[model samples]
Target chain A: MILQVAKSFILESIRNTGVFLGNLLPAFIFIICSWICTISIKSSPETLDFMIKGQFFPISIMLLVFAFAFSSATIYLADLKANNTIHLLKRTNISPAKYFLGIGLGVFLMMNFVLLLLLAGYSFIISLSISALISIILICNFVLLAIYPLCFIVAGIVKNGKVAQSLLVPIMLVFMFSITMTSLFLTINEQQPQDYYIYLIWNPMLYLSDTLQFQLNLNDHTWLPLYQYSIILTILCMVLSIFAKQIYIRQD
Target chain B: MLILDKVQKSYQNHSVLNGISSTFQYGHCYLLLGDNGAGKSTLLKCIAGDEKVDHGSIRGNEHEDVSNLVALQYQFFESYSFLKVKEVIQLFTKLIANPSNIKDLYELLDIAQYEKTLIKNTSGGQRKALSLYLAFLMSKPIVLLDEPFADLDLKKKKQLFGFLQNQVHLQNKCLIIISHEIKGLESLFDFVYIMQDGQFIEHGTTEELVEKYKNPTFSGLEAVYFEVTGQLLGGRIK
Candidate 1:
């Protein structure tokens, strides 16, 4: 049943051209920005390589994850709820857990596939070691796992797809602004800042962005080690998953 | 057979279903007739296990589980707008363990012509037809339909009435419907339930109710509804 629902979700994602393109928009924007940056830094190949690997690639992946979690996953679930598909399936004796698992599996598969493609594209522009590639994949998946549960919670609150779409821009902007601020704060400060801990603790995207920067040896001023970030993210994922299950199951 | 004993449901202290006790037997077509917000659809949801009753029990016979035995078609059918009609059918056919033959359902619902059409592009009537087809496709013994004839045209409504009747009498399936469009289709239902303010004011076979509320001013379910609720159907005057 999970596989069947996942297949149907994938088929629907493919058939819906608008959403499919929206999912790929981050990748397209990354490629175009990389092209523009490549021309400006043509004289210094090493600087260009660092820029792409250390900054562009990781930020793009973050954006991709955000897009998947909010735009694709949230709207898909909201649409199902608004259209009465969830109720219809429930009436047919399909449990909420099975349906949600199928949807989550579908989103996970599609997001990973797109991530792989982005990695493949970047490999040609810069020399990427197998270990670096693996680390990137692992970290991105961690970020996805940490962030995915929030989609269910948000979808439960915003039961209409149209409403979710309308709120997408502002929500994405807020997330981006916080992560960007954290990145700027981390880059400018050499020592661990005491006051920023409260602000920095809540934003998973900052942990994701800076951890990727640290892993690539691009930024050495990371507040925490890679393992600590992973632990924090795992905890966040668990907490969010519990809340998500409660909200989603309670939905009619 | 499905039984609801003293079923009660409420939201934020506003009672939606107030002690709705009834028995829906197999091989019979039952119509839950009421005005808007009269708990018709809520009752169906309770029976289908989509909504929990605040008080009381809803159960099928000893061998049957109410949730497992029932199939429900909601009033609005706007899901899967991106998929083609046939693809939606295929997806559900695969999800359901024992789906009825798609070919017969396609022909019965006249969905063959729209098989290639995207569901978003289909007319309201077509979507309603597709919804009806899916509800019946599950082959569940108890089928609950909420406003099955809402978006359908007169001809399509007639066709659906015939199909539902055949399912009840020939296949011995229990069919429960919530609808207010039963002027000339009185004979389609074997039993009629008149709901008012979240409670059943009267329920009986159409002939029995009409005879019980016999009046020259109105006839059929309309007469019974008027006599019981002291209001005309759709507020129409004799």
Candidate 2:
């Protein structure tokens, strides 16, 4: 039953014309930006790396947050409003734990699939090496997993898809501005060791972009260990999952 | 068999069901007559486990769980997606594990063509019929229908009443139907329960109640409803 529910949700998300367009449009924008970045630079290898490095973190955060919110939060809330199955399931033999697990698993798989496709396109165009590609994938996976549970959290609070999408707007905007500002600062100086940047240590996006940079030997970070971020992300995801269950109970 | 003991329910501070106790046996149809706020739907929801009782025990047969217990067709049945009629029937068929043929259900509702139509595009009467079809297909021993005849035309209403009569008389599913028009249903139901101010005051077999009250003017269901519930037939009982 869990697998059946999860598969149905995934299929529904993929088939929703709006969600599909939302996913495609962003990745298309990313492609356009990357192309523009490459064409406009016309500089040496170090200069190009420095320029790309500065922009990557902010752009990745914007896209990741968008992808996660649309595929995870918006679609889930729509299913809640439009489907009697959610209410029926609540009143059935299926436990709330199992039902939410199905939803979470579905969202995780979809976000991961979309992330891989986006990253694969970026790697193919940039001629990224094996290490850089692997590093980027790892970083993307971390942020995706960490932030994915939040969709359920938002879905639990929001009554419908449109409201859920609206609720995410402010949060996404703030994260986007912060990430962009951080990236702008990081790109300007090659001599400034990344360890001196105090703000990057606290940001999930920075962890991902920096992990990739370190993998490519493009930058260094001595401020914090990667395991610390992983631990924090894991704890946050679990708490969000538990909170989502409570919301389900309250809503029912 | 079904049993309720001291069941109470409230919304915010307004009490809907207050210490109500009733027992229903198999092979009987009961008309749950009440005024509009008399908590007919709330009682049904509590019975179906769709709403939790404030302070009481709803004990049923040991074998009955969420799926096999009472099946409810709410006043406004909302479908998750625009499912084809056949798909909805097939789903409850699987869930119930013992359902009549889809064609038979469709034909009985006088809506065989609707089987191919998306539920979203169907008319109100068609949707109501489909909701009835799904509930009947579930075939749970206990069926609670809230205004099943609403939105139905006169002909469709007669057809539904026919189908319901067959289910109660032949299949022996315990039914609690809430409707204001109790004239024709006097012969159809074995028992009549009247509700007023979230309480059941009088309940007995239709014959027993009518025979006990000798006056023809006062013996009919509308008379008993007005006498017990203290309101006109169409007045809100809440």
Candidate 2 C-alpha lDDT tens digits along A67-91:
7644455556555655455654443
lDDT of 1 by residue, B35-147 (tens): 78888888888888788899999997874669878888877689998889988888788777788764655776678888999898999878888888899889899999988
Q: Give candidate 1 misplaced runs (Cα > 4 Å).
A: A41-54, A165-177, A192-203, A220-235, B11-14, B62-65, B151-158, B214-219, B226-232
Q: Tens digits of per-residue lDDT for model 2 on B20-46?
A: 998887788988888788888899988
Per-residue lDDT of A59 in model 2: 69
Report the CAPRI category for model 1.
medium
* Best candidate (score: lDDT): 1
**Residues A148-231 of candidate 1: C-alpha lDDT, one tens digit per residue:** 888888888985988888887887777766766655576577644434656768767777677666667776657777678789
Please state the error at residue B77 of candidate 2 in Å. Answer: 2.8
lDDT of 1 at B116: 92
- The DockQ scores of all candidates, in the order shown, are 0.53, 0.25
